[model samples]
Target: MTDRAVAVRTAVFPRDTATVSRLAAAYHSQTESEKVERALTDGDAPLPERYAREIAEPATAFHGRRVVIASVGDDDCGMVVVAATPTGTDVSRLWTTPDARGHGVGAALVTAAIDDAAVPVRLSVWEWREPAIRLYRRLGFEPVASWDDREKMVCLERR
Candidate 1:
């Protein structure tokens, strides 16, 4: 699907791993940056070491999952990881790069993640990520009972 300046599509493994890994690292960096800002995590380790497994093994890091990529022109700027569970499809790692914010990249990615999902689509986000929560809620996700054990995590579902 294409909207605004963004183009969305399922990521093809190996061929897309380079792009996926790059985005995943950026996502992880943003996460670490947030956690550092909130004092939830320390930046003692190197950036790559902090996300070594994920950056090094995009395919296996999120095993058995579908990855969606969003791009504007030549810049691949957003991604989400989708996986099926007994309950419903779960969405995670949804992110829009810093430079690509507010251009419908995130919405397009969420739409792609849910487009072919089974039954309801589920996702969890950190409570502090108000922008992400707002976007998810705007896209038909509603607050759901906590399904994750992480502190202050907000679970939402769209059925």
Candidate 2:
């Protein structure tokens, strides 16, 4: 189901590899930018080559992950990745384009992914991303623990 407010259309990737890959490249770029920022903050060097390779060829990273994409009409707005874990499904990635922010794109994508899960959903967000944390909280995800010094893990049980 598409979100009427944002007019977001959600789909499982690989089914439409060409469109999904293009959208995925955009998502990858956004994620890499965030990674670079985090690297700078942590005084670590950014792995440009690795990022490029991973984005150019996503099969390895997406092997076991279920990927979902959101689009507004013909324009891709965002994407999310969920993988089944021992305890539940792990939401490994969620990214929205700048133009898609404040329009429910992220929420739509996340909700669609979580709705398809057979178990609880877990996710980790960078501590500095207050907006994303707030979004997760609003969606009924509770803080479970600190994944690392930089990220906090949250979980949403099936309801």
Candidate 3:
């Protein structure tokens, strides 16, 4: 792994949107993509149409959320969207570039989300994302009743 401790900072609007827009877009693309039967090459992914407006207006899109970017040295590697609630902190989004995987980018992002959170920090991830589920479990998140309506979503909480 790299020697750098992943540094995280909350994204500032207008000035920072351009940089994070691409990352946020990638996150949506990856999450919406389907797995192949066999021998299929990963093609250029199309951004999910539903997120078009959000990507277009991040200033208003993340109205109740916190966009925290994770960087190592000078390069931004991952991001997480957190929202505080009366019961707990909800981590609605977490994403890391493929190149940054296995190097603690995801962990850092989640840790940053938890740093200022209330007693319970919650998140909902797709059932297929085993690696992400493992990472959350390692960070003390346990399976909880889903707060999301999406299919195959597994909700978890850290208290």
The order of the candidates by TM-score, greatest first, is 1, 3, 2
Give the per-residue lDDT digits (tens) of candidate 1, residues 60-106: 78778889999999889989999998977999999888778888999
Give the TM-score comparing model 3 with the true structure, all chains together. Answer: 0.86
Check candidate 3 and list the clashing pairs.
none
Give the clashing pairs for model 1: none
TM-score of each: 0.90, 0.72, 0.86
Assess the local accuracy of residue 4 in candidate 1 as a C-alpha lDDT between 0 and 100.
50
What lDDT tens digits, residue by residue, belong to model 2 across residues 42-141?
A: 3254446644544665555577776777777667767787788887787866878777787798888878878868567777776666788888888878
Better of 1 and 2 by lDDT: 1
For each candidate, the alpha-carbon lDDT, in order, equals: 0.87, 0.66, 0.82
Give the winner by TM-score. 1
Segments of candidate 1 deviating more than 4 angstroms: 1-4, 45-51
- CA-RMSD of model 3: 3.6
